[model samples]
Target: MKILYKKGIAAVCRIAALYFMAFLIGACPVAAEEEQKTPGIHTWADLQEAINESGPGELITLTGNLTALSSDSGLMIPAGKHLTLDLNGYVLDRNLDSWGEFGSVIQVNAGAVLTVRDSSVSGGTITGGYHNNGGGILNRGTLILESGRITGNTVLHTGGGISNDGTAILLGGSITGNEALLNGGGVCNKPKGHMTICADVVSGNQAPEYDDVFNQGTLTLQEAEPEEFHFEDMTVVRSYMEELAILPFLVMLAILLYVVWIDSYLSRERKRIMLWIVLLVLSLILQNYTEYRMSMQVG
Candidate 1:
């Protein structure tokens, strides 16, 4: 009876060992997958593939600067995907040459969510083409800019930095050194889009119509001071003529100086000299008053 009991115990131990081994073997692949990290993207093709094939809410990290190929239309985040692009202090350039005349640098399609942070979008000098708008980024879905730089992009039509057609939330970022031929050198918010800027993030942009931003849709500046953003159409304290008149004022002052100091007849004419001085003083007063009003409005 003792020998029979020892055999039964040995059989139970063998069965338990087998079950433990099976559990480890079944868990090995999943553990390995969990331990593996996705490689950082280094090339444009690789980046595009990652953007296209990534699952929703996947993170794509850039390992280096990437420039689009000549034949590429552009990188696009497809509809219904949510992706976060960590620029990793690198750049996503559309091109350095004339290839940017074709398509935008990045297009976030409708129903997609893209968050760009910690990098630069400073290439893509776009020119005459069907894709003249949104040289840096064309966002039709939801875009969140947490931090980074959008600079040095040139577009023929509008939105040299970014064109928003859906929703854009700018928490922090610099949109500078971008140029648009017509309007909205930094950003263009379209008629159907909604944009909210919660920080001071735009400056040094160039356009004939609007220097920093053009808002045809809804623009909410949450807690942003009036002096923080320069909008051509929305200056409350000054008109366009008032802004442009500074140079003419300087020119007139120069003429007055020449008449008072250089021209012999005007220099001797006390009444004319007094008249010029009075006019100069009045101009200075007007300029000062305009600036004071602007400051009050800002305050």
Candidate 2:
């Protein structure tokens, strides 16, 4: 019975060590698959259909300029959906009728989330012709502007560039060359709105009341430097760390239990000591490699 018990403990330790190594191997980054290119959106119908069919948090990129028709009111993002539009140096312009009448170029419905960014350094433009209000964008949901140019939009009432009734966060962008006859040539934060401008260029806007911005709700201008960690890079590192963190603790616990429960057997067994050393060394190597990869990604 003593011999059988000793064999069972040894097997358990071996199994634990194997599992530890397996987990460490799993933490290594897999070779990325060839990415499939998302087709560009050209026509208004295709654009709206893509938005309607897109899942939450999906990214849609533009390859060419798109102009809204006179019959079209605006591009509407429905509630409860989150979408990101990456303008790859393309324009989103609103087409005006002979009378130069049109609605806002884009309207974000309440309970939705929209992020507008430019993949190219020159950035993309969101401009419009004459409109009643919010010539460029009328946002009632959450809006995140990472990088883009909102310019050359003229409005009769307010918000020539952007009308934010919900939450708006400007991480890096330029809001300029927008004109409002009444107020808020660059941006308008309505009564229930909340806006935070961290890094943005707001100038060359003309308004009868407020030249650049009109705020009735809460508005904060941080004017701070950009954050070191980007979302995409951080996500990859975080997932690997979260999965890899548990294996070390389990391996140490197994080693501890083995030492405590069978000290005499462990001391007599040189093989067991070597096995522990190997596992520790391998664990250290894997941990260092993972950390190095993370540093490279962030740096």
Candidate 3:
């Protein structure tokens, strides 16, 4: 009875924590003076107004992607404060009807510190005489991209997918299938910033010259190994090599591991269980540090 009660309380706490996290991902920690723009709820003028009106140590949220094309508008996050720009969802093709030529899906002007996550940018078409610097994302400050897709965009200059001219760090995500008419098809990392593609892909991006794909950037490809895991108290086992989903892998692994470990016909095997446990312990040691390092960098 005591154990059952304890389990019930733990479950309730876990659920409450999850809800709290969902609200706080882009909600609190920012100063009250900072303004928030829920593009889904507010107008472009409202978003820009809040950004300009926000004081230092303040932040502005892009509740969703800003299709502020050629509006000559990308958000500006002031320095000295932690300005987190949560892309909440996808930022699609720019609004060409708004900006004539000098437009970008996103342009973080100089001297700002910004953090973006859990979002994407795609289908950017800049037809006017002006250039589309970054079809997806353009940064001139401190930028961080965590866990999402940045694909299928065309650019004329650096970072056909993304261009960071100041200090930047890309911790984990896909940087592929973007086009550069003149420069880097995937990324043009200038300035003193560094890009570490930890356990990710930098493939399938296009450049005018194949040899001209990468220039003036340092790429450290620290690939992560497949995780060895068993699933959901099931019999199967699954291992993930690249960017595979978690729940599916767990389901498969449970089935496989059960088959290898148990049998109604076979007597209990102490040796086998011990061997597997030792292997698991070693894997935990190796993987913990790698996962920790990937999460710490600012990209």
Candidate 4:
């Protein structure tokens, strides 16, 4: 009886061990897949492939400049997907007249959300079609530009740089040197579309009617405050502000590292570090407050 019981216990232990191993093996692939699923885009084909595979809220970064070889339809955002394309200081050139069809350099389909930043869209020409609009970008969905350039685009009808039939928000960028044969050389907001330009420059665009912008729908322009940096001017102030914006975060990180390193040291050193941090933070706060007050008084 004892021999039989020992055999049964050994068999049970082996089965349990097998089950545990299987469970671990099954779990490893999932974690590994997530870690390995980094998407990179260097060419137009790679960008298209990544866009097709990505779902909503996925961010795709451009690894290099991509110039369209053929006039095939530009990159299309899948419907219902909110994707962010980080241009990473790259350029998307449509290589105008490569194809005999009408297409924008970047098309945001209906019900899709696309945010483009830190990139440039140029050398796109849209013509000879029913929808000859938005030579640089045709947005039927929601489009947002944080900082980029839309220039040197041509359209036969309207929106030499951008055409919107949905919603577009320009936070900071420049739309210049685009030409439209008819109207809205910089941007065209259709009847169903809405555009909000907050601190963007729309200038030097050529159109028969509205040289800079044409709005048939809702258009709101929020000019920057006098003290704020005007991105269009590209002045010394803008450059200074851009450079200074990262200093506060860097200082905070340094302070954090100092605190961590001093945790094992004497109480006096800890107190001194704490005092320095407090003083630095307080100075920053006071400086910001003073600037705000001065701006208000000037206004």
The segments of candidate 1 whose C-alpha lies over 4 angstroms from its true place after superposition are 1-40, 96-102, 119-131, 224-299
Q: What overall lDDT, based on C-alpha atoms, would model 3 receive against the true structure?
A: 0.49
Cα lDDT for residue 11, candidate 1: 55
TM-scores of the models, in the given order?
Answer: 0.62, 0.64, 0.49, 0.60
Model 4 alpha-carbon drift over 4 Å, by segment? 1-35, 97-100, 119-131, 225-299
* lDDT tens digits, residue span 29-89, model 2: 3322112223447787678888888786666777688988767667888998788877767
Report the Cα lDDT for residue 245, model 3. Answer: 32
lDDT of each: 0.67, 0.73, 0.49, 0.68
Ranking by lDDT: 2, 4, 1, 3
The best candidate in terms of TM-score? 2
State candidate 3's TM-score.
0.49
Q: Give the TM-score of candidate 4.
A: 0.60
Rate residue 4 of model 2 by lDDT: 92
Backbone clash count, each prediction separately: 0, 0, 21, 0
Tens-place lDDT digits, model 1, residues 180-215:
889999889999989987666778999999988999
Q: Which tens-of-lDDT digit does each residue in 1-299 have in candidate 4?
A: 98778668755754553354344333222322443456546677788888888765665666677877653557788788777766656677777742236567888889988877663353222222123798888999988876677887888899988999999887766788888889999999999999988754688989999998999999988787323533332223443564465466446545544544454332677557655654554455445544543332221
**Best by lDDT, which number?**
2
